[model samples]
Target: MKINNKDEYIIIVGCGRLGSHLASLLSKERKSVVVIDNNEKSFNRLSKNFSGFTIEADAIEEETLLKAKIDKADVIVTTTNDDNTNVMVAQIAKSIYKVPKVIARLFDPSRQEIYEELDIDTICPTILSAIEFKNIIIEAGGED
Candidate 1:
């Protein structure tokens, strides 16, 4: 389902750089956002202007997912540093709760195929950085 309206709910797992950034952007747009992280200190990354539900708990746990109301979420984005943890949470969101959209951030590019097989959308910064670096080099004609 398309979240064109502000009332649509978006759940973000992990409050690190990527997760916090996404939550801040979505919150600024007035979208209903819920951010989960194991460490409460991690929530400090969020901007003071952000007005979204912050849950301090391990997202890999089913209980945390329940508290976050994963079932009613229109979209779930897992940005944990661990590829395995991201995969597990993504699968639960997609297969069990059947969230309409599930996105994950994976650091390892090799695991892209695994996430693809599970029909989970993934953003790999490593791969993106590599591609961007290559493009810059090509455009610079390999000049110093």
Candidate 2:
């Protein structure tokens, strides 16, 4: 689903690199955003100009999801470093809270099929990086 509307409510789980970047971008575009993370310091990744709300709590916890008001979220993104945690958060947002759109970041490409089976959208950096590196090698005349 597209997030062209600036008035949409976006919830991002994990305030790490990806999560913070998304929060900043959405916030800049005037979307209502809430970022959740277990470590308070992780929020530091967010830009100083970010105007979104932040909650220091484990996103895998149901209470934390409730506190973030997931029920009202138009989109939920899970970008924690751990694949399992990201999957759990994405599942909770999509399955339990019934968030309209749920996206997750997974480092392990092997587990992507599992999430896809559950109907959750995923972005796998590992796979993307491999593709980019393969392209670079091919450009350099390296054999496949």
Which candidate achieves the best TM-score against the true structure? Answer: 1
- Looking at model 1, the pairs that clash are none
lDDT of 2 by residue, 1-144 (tens): 466574399999888888899899999988899999999999899999999999999887889899999899889988888989999989988888898889999988888898899999999988889999999989888654
Candidate 2, pairs of clashing residues: none
Candidate 2: misplaced stretches above 4 Å? 139-144
TM-scores, one per candidate = 0.91, 0.90
Model 2 Cα shift for residue 137 (angstroms): 3.7
**Candidate 1, residues 4-107: lDDT per residue as tens digits?**
67448999999999999989999999899999999999999999989999999988889999999999999998998888898899999999999988988899
Superposition error at 125 for model 1 (Å): 0.3
Q: Global lDDT for candidate 1? A: 0.91
Clashes of 2: 0
Model 1, position 12: C-alpha lDDT score:
95
